[model samples]
Target: MFSDNREQLSRSSTFKLLLYFLACIGMIYTVFVHQVYLSSDTFHRKQLDRELSQETEIFTALAGIGNIDAIRTLIAEKQSIASPFTYHIQPISTQTASLSYPAALTGDQPYFELSDLKSGSSLLLDDDTILRIEINRDLLQKYREDLAPMMISGVALPVIVMIAGAVWFAVNIIQKLQRVNFAMNRVLCGEKNVKLAVSRNDDEFDILSIHLNFMIEQIEKKEASLKALTVGVAHDLRTPMARMKLRIESLLALTSNNQQQQELEACHDDLELLLGMFNGLLEIANLNSGKQLISKQRVDLTTVAQDAVDFLQPLAEEKQQQLILRQDAAHQLDGEPSLLFRAVINLIENAIKYTPEEGRIVVVIDAFGIVVIDNGEGISDLDKLQVCEPMYRADKSRSQSGSGLGLSLVDAVMKRHGGELVLRDNSPGLRARLYFN
Candidate 1:
């Protein structure tokens, strides 16, 4: 779950925005620290350098005046008072060094070793005596010690607050987007009434929700208008088609001319096909409009599959195909028995219509759903995406005799049952599954 959440966050624009903000903050903080350290270091180093120069001049003047005793006494006084300075005196005639320097400063070091926490200067007087003065960088150390906490709080506190705020903002934006996504998914699933929740703040997200709600409303209105028009046209044509079918049947009963009878029978069959298409359109429209309430009961899916197979077995056998059912146990779920049976029948019929002679068709029943697999010229990848639409016939199935509402009606039935019809490519065939929730 954590990994999934992390992945989602990584893909989120809000999270990316936060990362960019943090990068900028980090850059600013680095530059700020560098500048602060440079300014503080330069100030303290210059101050220490000036003090060292002054101390060296004082001792040099004493050596020039030949007051060596005064210089020695002053050095002794400084050592006794625990001053930060250390002194070293060397005479060229004696070729020996005075051991007055601190243990940490006993080397013949350069004038400035700032990194060693010490700075020094030396002068050669007229008496050929060398004087060196070194001072501990205690002031710089103190400044660093005092500035550490300030720098930490200065950068850390703001960073922490910004991170917290950014996290909250990202979460808020993601939640709003998720709600919108969920609503759109419901709409896609045929629930046109679903609407996004609008918050009272009227922020951008809320505005987006409002606009989406308006769009859904418009879509619902247009769909209702279209469905009404379709239903109306079908109803108007249905009566005339029924009359035509009856007339053709009457002519068949009256006239015994073989050719005329065959033509009339063909006309009757065409009329029946037209009537069936109209009825299917009306059924789908009623199902989609929620005007038809499904009466649900605990129905055994295996029995429904058995019924469909038994009904369609003769048709499959006529095509020299095998109709097989594989069910280990009875899987019972709450659904409309008639609708479930119709959906299964439609799927099996489509399989029989498309599969070649000597092909195999299997109906598998499980706890979750029913699957109908057929070894036929399967639907193309492109056609599978739109084959379920009303009156949409794939190129492969175009020459076949169908109004092209079989899959659409099955889809409607599944929706009415709160299930789904999923079509898959079974390698060399088609696999259709009816998944029930």
Candidate 2:
């Protein structure tokens, strides 16, 4: 099955951008929550200290002129109120009436110690009376209860919005890219006029579509120009070449000199070679330009392989070589018979040309594809890739009699049939595979 997940995460800029956005949002949430928590802590601590300072001054004033009893009475009256701070007098009374006390308290500065407030100061009277005030317990829990929901909402709302936006953006971009890929595939499959629809927004995808459409147009123009030029040159040369051959033959008949006849024969052979080259070029151009009409029907590839083997058997016999066909399976495909025949012929001919005398050649028809193998010196790794290009021949095959257009023509034919021609090492020789899609 075709999958887009790997492509989206690894290749899509939109997906990567959304991931970065989410990362940044998370970082901001963490920093904002930390700072806000600290600010709330400082504000509550300052308020507590201010209240403690005010209460200390009031008690000292009430205990003026050595009136310890009055100070005690004043403390007893204030303890009746429900306040965050709970005050107590030790060595004087068991306890004051208060709902609860701060669980931890230390120092006269009224600092928090594990949810409790502890502070104490001595009152100077005629005798001695020390008043100790300690605040403790549940302060931290109460603060957290108030701050938790507010802090959570502050971060959660934006995070939710960002996540939704990221999903929406990634989906939209993927859909647009899929459409573009579909259009490009059509073009690659030989639809020269196919073009993607450019969006009005002029986004990155739109720009890419514009460039791709332009590239396709350039390719079409170049191919059309090349085909026209090849056709014109081939047409222009055919008649002159024909007339020259006829004239040379006529001259040979009239001349009685043996040397003159030999020269004329050489000229005739050269003219025939030139004609053959032109014909090959014209055929390649026609196949690549899609000018030749192809009537695709059910073609039995095993039969094709057998026919090619039969035709090349005489040539192989002349050189004392073996040419065999092994049909493991009979496969049928939709293609033009003549073109497919030409492709198989080119492969068999190439093998025959390269293979030495008494060499073995086999044409195998299997479920995978059609493969032509020869027990000869295999093509070099460097030459294998360039062998399908027009006029490209390996250095080892330089002296061989060929137009060097045979493999190029076969490559063109395979592509027209929605297939590929792959060249690989055949252990001791070369293996040419024609794969159908």
Candidate 3:
């Protein structure tokens, strides 16, 4: 559902690592809080101990009174002062200790009171009632409120420091990046000697700077070589071109016979093809140098394919071959219209040249895609690999039909737009599919 964001992630490694550490801290702090300060049963047990002691003293006071009725009256009167203390009247026994302390005392409120038999001279509860002591769930909450902040502070401070440290490191990296970017800008603005500072950490940024400098060095070498080549070739080819032009003009003037005229026309054609090849080479260089930017817009592949097929129909008919056209998704795209049309035309023309008079050419177009299929003998895999290489041709003579640079030019055009020419075997024919975005 998503593209690889590895490049972006790599750029923000420090920030990502810091966030990871912060998340771990938060989790550990949460677990600590839950364990240390949030336990209710422990609170209940402690509260029960306190209640038990207080109830023992109260029962001792009531035990000295021998009148059971009088003692019951006094206990009833004091019930309000002893909240959460319960008294249950039953046959009290040593075995009842298992039922134990306050039966309903929660963690917060411990249930504790007196009970026993008067016969033993011990107040059953006061004169013959049993008492139970226990703690309840409320004691836990009471303890939690008192200790929660202390526990959180103890845990969260370290975590907060760690998070802040991560953020600080990220900010440091960002500041370093800004400085590096300023240096790069100065270099781009003609300060050729400007270079990035090398960091000693041996991290990815250090590797990137080293590689970038190496690339700049290579580019400088290539640029020097290209300049020398262009100047040398211009000097060499200029003389030959001028001499050929003079010879062609002279031949036209020296004879008006049909035979001489045909020869001169052929000679001119050869020189013109040479000029075209050189011009094509220059265009390829322009593409490689990124001087030519493609206009990126939604282009209708169907419309472009149909137009190409129509342009080749007359040629196909002259060759006694049928040209079939099919198209889909007539949507527009971000592209150079003239360049795209020229590319399509070149493919169709190439197919026509290879196709026999009785053969068929099929042109297909789908939304944002195109394919030109032909019923001519297919190209072998080895030949297909080099088919788009400049000046490379499987058929050496080219039957005096094409300059042998057509596919190469087309490949260069599509590549500039981030597209490619896919050569596939179409059974008895060759299929040239151009995929574009």
Candidate 4:
């Protein structure tokens, strides 16, 4: 289940959109951090440089006035106040002759390492003395620590909120699409009354729903018209065909010549075929239109399969085929007894008609349905799908004698019972199953 769900999420457009959104957010955050780091470093460096430059200028001016004592006094004041600047004064007369300005300040060593001196400045005094000043690194460190939390919260809060909103939006869109998909599936399953609900919010989804409903309405009208036309034509032709059959039977009775009698018998058989085809067409149309209601009762599927097998056994034996039934127990379900019987009969009849001589046929009855398997010339994979359609004959079955309405009628009956007719390749033959819910 976990793997299935992960695969589904990987295929979902919403998940892909979410990943894209996160990637974009990450990129923006990275750029923001880069810019913030550069700006902060530049600002702190400039502040440090200004502090060192100002200190050096003050000491150099004091030296220019030849006031070494004043410089020493000012250094002492800075040391007393615990200033962050350190000063070093050295005379040109002797290389090592340097005054620490404030001896305690020189020993204080405010910086941890040479790198800690963020900015430094030096000036040569008129008295041949050098003045040097260095700014403390603690000021920049403190500033960074203070700004760190603000920068994090500034980006973190918005990112979290945007992600939440994106997820909600993606879920909402997916749910709406699912609704439309479900309705479309129902329509594909022959539920012409199914329609997508419109929220009337005038959004894109609402507009889509409205258009789909209109399209369904148009399809329902056209389908009803076509079904009515087919039913009407078949109904009209069946009556005339029955009259023709009666007249042909009378002529057969009146004929005395053997050749004419044989010809009349052939005409009678053609009429019977036509009548059967028309009847099938009308029955299918009625079932599709819901005009033929199914009265459901407790039905024994095993009995149904046995009856179908028994009824068609002679036909199978005529071809030297072996017809068998495999039923372990009584499988009962709620369905129309006559319709289920007819469906079983149609499947078994098709097997007998298509199987070659000396072939084997088996009708297996189970809890959910019955499977009719045959070891004959099987239908191709592509033909299996089209064979269930009315009047559709596979190339292999074209030479066989059938009206091609057997599977179509069985399919309609299965649908009327809220079941399905599934066709499979039985390796060397066809496996036709009528499943009941």
Where does candidate 2 have its weakest 10-residue lDDT segment? 108-117
Tens-digit per-residue lDDT, 237-306, candidate 1: 9999999999898999999899999999999988898899999999998887788888899989988999
- Model 3 lDDT per residue over 99-139, tens place: 44333333432334443321111233432345343332354
Model 2: how far residue 378 lies from native, Å? 4.4
Instruction: Give the whole-model CA lDDT for all candidates, comma-separated.
Output: 0.81, 0.78, 0.69, 0.79
Which candidate comes out best when scored by TM-score?
4
lDDT of 2 by residue, 1-437 (tens): 12665556467788888889798978988698879987887777667767766776676565444455777777677767655555655542333443223332244333211122334333333222346654433664687777878887878887888877887778777888789889988876567688889879998888999999999899989987976887799878988998999999899889999998999999999999988888888888788778877999999999888888898889999999999899888788999988899899999998998899999999999886799999887899988868887777785546788878999999999989999999989889999999887
Name the better of 1 and 2 by lDDT: 1
- lDDT, model 4: 0.79
Model 4 per-residue lDDT tens digits across residues 111-220: 11111234565544433555556665575677777778777777778778877776667666767887999999998766758878888599999999999999999999
Work out candidate 1's RMSD over C-alphas. 6.6
Worst 10 residues of 3 by lDDT: 118-127
Better model by TM-score, 2 or 3? 2
State the number of backbone clashes in model 4: 0
